[model samples]
Target chain A: MIQNLTTVWRFRHFLLALVRLDLRLRYRRSILGVGWSLLNPIAMTIVFALVFSKILGGDDLTRYVPHLLIGLAVWGFLKESATAGSRAFLQSESYIRQSPLPLGIYPLRVVLGQAIHSTIAIAVAVVVTLVYQPYQPEPTDPLAILSIVPGLILMFLVAWSAATIFAFVNVYFQDTQHLLEVAAQLLFFLTPIIYTAGKLVGKAWWWLELNPVQIILELIRTPLMKGHPPTADRLLAGLYLAVVMITLAAGTAAWLRKRVIFHL
Target chain B: MAKIALTDVSLTFTVHQRKRVTLKEYLIQTVVHRRSISTAVSVHALAGVNLSLRDGDRLGVIGHNGAGKSTLLKLLAGIYPPTVGTREVEGKICSLFDISLGFEPEATGWDNISYRAFLQGESPASLRGKMDGIAAFTELGSFLDVPVRHYSAGMMMRLAFSIATAIEPEVLLIDEVLAVGDMAFQEKAQARMKEMMGSARIMVLVAHDLKTIRKMCNRAIWMQQGRVMGAGPTDEVVDAYIASVTRTAAA
Candidate 1:
């Protein structure tokens, strides 16, 4: 595992170049590039804010709008990683056949590409919260801002691992991407992105803690929106989620990395 | 000290007979392993091969298609791991098997260069110095700025070869990529291939062109059906490989 990390770190520049290549190709014939990609989610966020603000987190547009924005940003990262990560190795079959780099970087390519657009959305969310003076506790720590650095790192770990799993899974089952796309649509409604977590008053609400994404979202949202880092329990929860994901990724990679080119 | 050693190596690919197997079917097959109705059939691409190499070895591999010549190169390059044996390679290996396949068609020649170079393990700092050399070699001029999808096959291959060879390889693995580019560029590519082969500590090439192999390599191997049919001095191997081919044709 350490060796794998070192291999990926050694090729950090390659990953950056691939991400840039993906960015340029994505915007090759289209303008409003990222804005257009995010338009759907941004539109969805607005609709949710208008519909559920009063019903859930209260009618405060300041609090609710930023919340929805952050939620959708993370959702975008998760969704794009699933959809694009499945094609990561398939698209790079030439590279895989030509040389031996760590198989991990291929999925990282997809994760990094998705991360950029989500980063922009997250930045916009932060700005909105600042503009709203943040609907937070009166004595929230100003130093909590530093937590965003760790927050982003944790988010990347989660995204990269999820993408690695999806990439390997898709190599084995060609329809994994199609299945995930349908699954993602269901996940959107099931996740608290459109509906506030606070409003869930039933038995299923207890299992929300098991939703690693919810933990990931709160880690970023607390520091950015509430002007305070999430409580220790939440941070630990995020850490556990990251560990679990990395394990799943490592497991999938161990099983499929060597023979992936055969399938490709 | 670049070196390569394969100890009793074999590679088997379990190719699905179908175009693809869905997760549902795969899961069902896995659960019902004994009574499975799966179409998974294993292809033995390489079988019980032993080879050794060191610095100053320019090894030529000749074989009919599907005889595992390219597979041996890929296995040496670490793209495909051996199923039953150990492969040990030292030094940075640069393989040029599918150099022209990964380019994004909608991206320009310049962009394709960056992408391919990076995949071949060139960092921005390293590529910056080599950019002018690569650009000059392609000679596409303003055409470099145009999307590669618009470029002819020969032009695309030219761009790919230039970028692929930009990295100074310590060990090179090539699979019949010398036959690319236009008439002039073909000679240029041949010279570049020679230059790269000359500089690398070790080089392995898989090709059907016996004359090119005999010219470029001091050592050669002839493979048939995933096994080595001949190995030794290039002249003897080439003669034997030709005899085998002629015998098959006559029969």
Candidate 2:
């Protein structure tokens, strides 16, 4: 694992170039360029606020808008990274066949590329927060910035782990990408992104506790929405989940590294 | 010194006859009907074979399509792990199987050069000094600023070949990609390849051009049906391979 990490670090320039190339290719023909990244979450937030605010029909509009926007932006990152990472190896078959590099770099490239897009989404969230001042209390906690540190790191690790695992399975099972798409769609609704976790009680609350996505959501959402760091228990739980996911991802990648070439 | 040794190495590829079924399809199929998915068909790409190479070895591989010449090169380059045995390689290895394999069509020639070299594990700092030389060799001139998609096939090959051959490694692996481009570029490429072959400690080339192999390689291997049919001095192997082909054609 150390050797693999070293190899990846040594080839960091290549990975960065690949990420840049992916971003350029993705938006090359579009007139708006990277404006789409910011627009996507903003558009979704407006639509969700319009529908849910009408259904719930309460004074929760100000509170819910920022919550939904942040949640959607983060979820968008997770969804794109996981889905694209799953196809990383398959998509880079040309490079893999011709050049010899550590296989881990491909998935990392996907994750990092999506991370950049997600950073843009986060920037949009910040702008929305500043412009609309949606938080009822207007979170003044100076530590809120510090709280986001762990959440961001944990989010990247989880996304990277998921992507590596997906990329590995995708080589042998071509349907993994489609499977991930369906799974991500289901997971979006299941997680407490649109609705606050505080609203759930008893059985519903138990479901949220069991859901890793909800835990991750809380890890990030608590800092931004509630003006507080996540509870110690919640932080520990998120860390443990991240660790387990990374371990499993690394184990599977090591076992499948050479074998993936055959499938490719 | 560079060295490569294979001990009874073998590779098998399992190709699925049917497309992979999604979870949705699988669940629906299981519920609606009682049918299982099709199994994959395994192809023995390379049978058990043992070979060894040391410094200053120029090994030429000649075989018909699907006869495992490329597979052998891939194995040596560490692209595919042996399914059965073991392979030990020492040195920095550079494999140029598909010259244009990693080029982004929408990226400019200069960007593609950096991208391709980076993929080969060259850092931007290390490659900066070599950039001008590679650019000049490609002869793309102002075309370097244009996207590779706009370049002609020959121009693309020139750019790919230039970037691929820019750096020298301890061991070099080449497939038949050198067969492209104009006659002038081919001669220039051949000279560049000869220089690379001389500088590299170990070189393995897979090509169909018998004359080139006989002239360039010290030793050669002829493969038939995933097994080495003959291995010996380059001249003898080329003569025997040509004779077998001509005799089969006559028959």
The DockQ values of the predictions, listed in order, are 0.65, 0.54
Off by over 4 Å in 2: A27-32, A127-141, B24-36, B63-65, B229-232, B235-251
Which of the CAPRI classes, incorrect, acceptable, medium or high, describes model 1?
Answer: medium
Cα deviation at A147, candidate 2, in Å, is: 1.4
Q: Worst 10-residue stretch by lDDT in candidate 2 chain A?
A: A129-138
For model 2, what is the error of residue B75's alpha carbon versus the real structure, in angstroms, after optimal superposition?
0.9
Across B40-136, the per-residue lDDT of candidate 2 in tens digits comes to: 7898999987889999999999989999998898888877778999999999888877676767888899999998888777888989999999999
Q: Please report the interface RMSD of model 2 to 1 decimal.
A: 2.1
User: What lDDT does each candidate get?
Assistant: 0.84, 0.84
The interface RMSD values of the models, given in order, are: 1.7, 2.1
Clashes of 2: 0
Per-residue lDDT tens digits for candidate 2, residues A155-259, read 899999999999988876678898898888899988888877766767787788778787787888777776667889999988998999999998998888877
lDDT (tens digit, per residue) of candidate 1 on A93-188: 777877678888888888888888677777777777677766467537777767877767888998888888988888878889999999998877
